[model samples]
Target: MLDFINRVLGRESGGSKEIAKERLRLVLVHDRASVSPQLLQALKTDLIQVISKYMDIDEKAMEVTLDSNERQVALVASIPVKSMKRATRTPAVSI
Candidate 1:
């Protein structure tokens, strides 16, 4: 009720509590994904490399994370693309 009232009043409720709870949830999801910080960093680097092959992306703003709910885990990536590379074709060789 208070939360609803706060919403209607154009204010936010559960300020620090909500933030702490969300942080805890993220830690739990990351732990359940069995991904260490080093592993996650490596994955992020590899992803940037592979994605860079086809497009120009903002490395400083890229974000990658393992997210989860009660049912399953998900790998999420937010990459800001500056531009896409033009598609190129190679000549085919006859067997």
Candidate 2:
């Protein structure tokens, strides 16, 4: 994809070697960050809860993905905004 983009932009292709190097760079980033897919999912869930307090959100539409290079991992998340509404009123009961 990078090569194709470079070519389309009239830039020299980095070639397979450059592509491999780039992959390694990303992997290293991921490794150093310690952000794996599982971690990202947990982070996404927490984020949704925190953000939901102020606004509505579609939990199903939430996205938490990870990309890794040779030694690095990157965490990416996408959450859509939703309308906020109060739930039905309930009568209080003594414990």
Candidate 3:
């Protein structure tokens, strides 16, 4: 609603510029990695699901990104966990 008005006014509609910039970054990263944006999204979704099984996460706040330097590439995940589950202990079996 408000975004429509901002667009009408020839303004960057409600932080859409930021969204566009981030999307562009994602595209660049994926292009360099030879992966499609859809593949990146699929990986992010899977990461969220797998991580959520062990923690209470703020799913909306999570971010997964690929970055590259002159020599190497990195896959980074920023997951905001509300609470992390403790590891369950098991007794050692005697021989």
lDDT sort, best first? 1, 3, 2
lDDT of 1 by residue, 21-47 (tens): 999999999887778999989999999
Report backbone clashes per prediction. Answer: 0, 13, 0
- Position 19, candidate 1: lDDT: 86
Model 3 steric clash pairs = none
Q: How close is candidate 1 to the true structure, as a TM-score?
A: 0.74
Shift of residue 60 alpha carbon in model 3, Å: 0.6
N/CA/C clash count, model 1: 0
Candidate 3 residue runs with Cα over 4 Å from true position: 1-27, 86-95
Q: Better model by TM-score, 2 or 3?
A: 3
| Overall lDDT per candidate, in order of appearance | 0.88, 0.74, 0.80
What digit string (tens of lDDT, one per residue) describes model 2 on residues 8-93?
A: 99987746888898788767666767667687677887998888876788899988766664554556667777785574445367
Top-TM-score candidate index: 1
Candidate 2 ranges with C-alpha deviation above 4 Å: 1-32, 65-76, 84-95
